[model samples]
Target: MGSNVDNALFFLVSTLFKLAIWVLILRVALQLVRADFFNPVSQLVWRLTQPVVGPLSGIVPRYRQWDLAGVLVLYVLAVLYIYAVFAILDYRVGLLPALWLGLLSLITMTLMLLTFSIFVQAILSWLGPGVNNRAGSVLWSLNEPLLSRIRRIVPMVSGIDLSPLVAILLLQVFYYLVPLHPVLR
Candidate 1:
């Protein structure tokens, strides 16, 4: 009975920690896209996450309007959360394994976000120019820099947008081929 209670508490805390990390990521992504940070949704996320990020921001400082400190703090939180969850579940995670898994999760999240943006862009284009979809706008804001660079390099083949395909392929390579820290292997 006590064990069950302990497990329940562990699960609850782990889930909340994970949710907090995701909320922080969403806040950063919103900032990246120039979303109204003061909107109810954004403000709620900021409020939930700032308690953790606020102090870290002071330590690392901001650069070029980019929140490298926030990203680093999120990464550290993710690693610590993973470690705690494993410890609570009685699983051993060596340093290398933890680092590799954390990196893998980060890469996966980034690729998923990129793929989602590409899918949104494709759908918006199909819906034609007049439809003003906010999702499309957000996707464009997130993806435009990467896609623009690709466009300059790749050019449009037969008037098709190959940038998305290229981006997906690159993401796939990172997902599968990259050798993680040796300790993980």
Candidate 2:
């Protein structure tokens, strides 16, 4: 396999795996926020993930509103993604290291996704404030938990809610500040 082919393969696999991982994160966050299950967006997430999460849901017990099955599936996908990346890059790493790297990658990706969701939510609000759309609704639901807490701490001034901005900054700091090079490396 040439370097170009390996790069292409890595890109393809990374995109597909990351897409699934993002959906799983949304699924878990949706449940955590108690988002409207009947919303079209919510239904789409459920249907898209059912084939993979349904079986795991049966095997993994739930804790309150937490989606343990979704979490398990996410971790497995993360590990598989890491393994695929290693193979594609021809890195001869050990299994345990891969497992640890997978965990780190998962957490990093999740935080990155959160930052993205908040950013998009802000855009949606700017584009159409008070718009009644399923996607926007889900986006708001995903963002409210974080924004609400921030809002409490940082009061709105002149009717401008600064929570989203503050939230994004905080999330950015946390994710970037966390050292990615684990003991395995």
Candidate 3:
């Protein structure tokens, strides 16, 4: 295939694969955070990933709340995606390096999701005191755990709640400090 065509195809495939991975990530994170499993968004994530995770769950096993099956699936997908990137670039990477970077990529993506959710939640709140929706509920469920902790130390200034900003700042700092996006480069 021509370089341009190859790159385009790779982008399309990677995007779809990444979307699936994000859904799995959501499932794992939601379980870990003890989010309402019956929530529509939660159910959607579960139903979407059930086919793949169901089979792996038999072998990989779930440790308490952590979904190891989903995690294993994520790792395999990431490793394969990393390998594809290396191939497209006409370069080679060891399995260990690829594995390490693949895990980092997962963390990087999770951090991105949290950061983005925080922004959206903040926007929704600004729109009104009670902007209830399925998406907002899911975002709140995922982020409230972290944001509440920040709220304890950082008091609201006047009428403005800075918890979201404070939380994002901390998350961003951790995100950068962890070298989370190594595979991305």
Candidate 4:
């Protein structure tokens, strides 16, 4: 009974922390992609993250399109989340190891976000065809830069834009190419 209760508690804590870490990551990525602030999804993400990020903004400067403060806060939160999970699980890891794992988690989360954004954007494109509604706009904001770069390089095949395909493919390749062993060791 005690072991079961402990396991349940571990799961609850870990899930909550993981969700928080994901939101923080989204806060950073949306800024990195320059997602439209007025979009409902963008506004929701900002509202969720603003409290944590607002306090750190003065300390960490923004670089061009990227919000450096948000990124830093995400990193701090990721590391803390990992540490908390380890503690809750009653598993011990050295400080350096925990930090490295946290970094690996961050990278994985970023790639996941990119892949998800691209996939959703692709679906939205297909569903609405030529519509430029707020949902489409939000998706475009998240996907446009990377897709535009891919479009430039890949070219349209017979006037059918294949940039989304290429972008998703490239993101998948990067996701699989990310090394996890280094962080684990």
TM-score of 3: 0.89
Tell me the spans in candidate 3 whose CA falls farther than 4 Å from its real position.
Answer: 1-3, 180-185
lDDT against the true structure, each candidate: 0.70, 0.85, 0.83, 0.78
What is the Å distance of residue 169 in model 2 from its true position? 1.1
TM value for model 1 = 0.67
TM-score of each: 0.67, 0.91, 0.89, 0.82
| Model 4 misplaced stretches (Cα beyond 4 Å) | 1-14, 181-185
Tell me the deviation in Å of residue 177 in model 3: 2.6
Q: Residue-wise lDDT of candidate 2 within 25-107, one digit each (tens)?
A: 88988999999999999999999999999998888999999999998998889889888877876777788987887888777
Candidate 3 lDDT over 20-107, as tens digits, reads 7788888888888888888898999999999988998889878998999988887888788778777876778998989997888777
Error of 3 at 154 (Å): 0.9
Worst 10 residues of 1 by lDDT: 176-185
* C-alpha lDDT of candidate 4 relative to the true structure: 0.78
On the 0 to 100 scale, the lDDT of residue 96 in model 3 is 95
The runs of at least 3 residues in candidate 1 whose Cα sits more than 4 Å from the true structure, single-residue gaps closed, are 1-22, 29-48, 55-59, 95-97, 128-130, 179-185
Q: How far is candidate 4 from the true structure (C-alpha RMSD, Å)?
A: 3.3
lDDT of 1: 0.70
Best by lDDT: 2
| Clashes by residue pair, model 2 | none
Alpha-carbon deviation at 71 in model 1, angstroms = 1.6
Top TM-score: which candidate number?
2
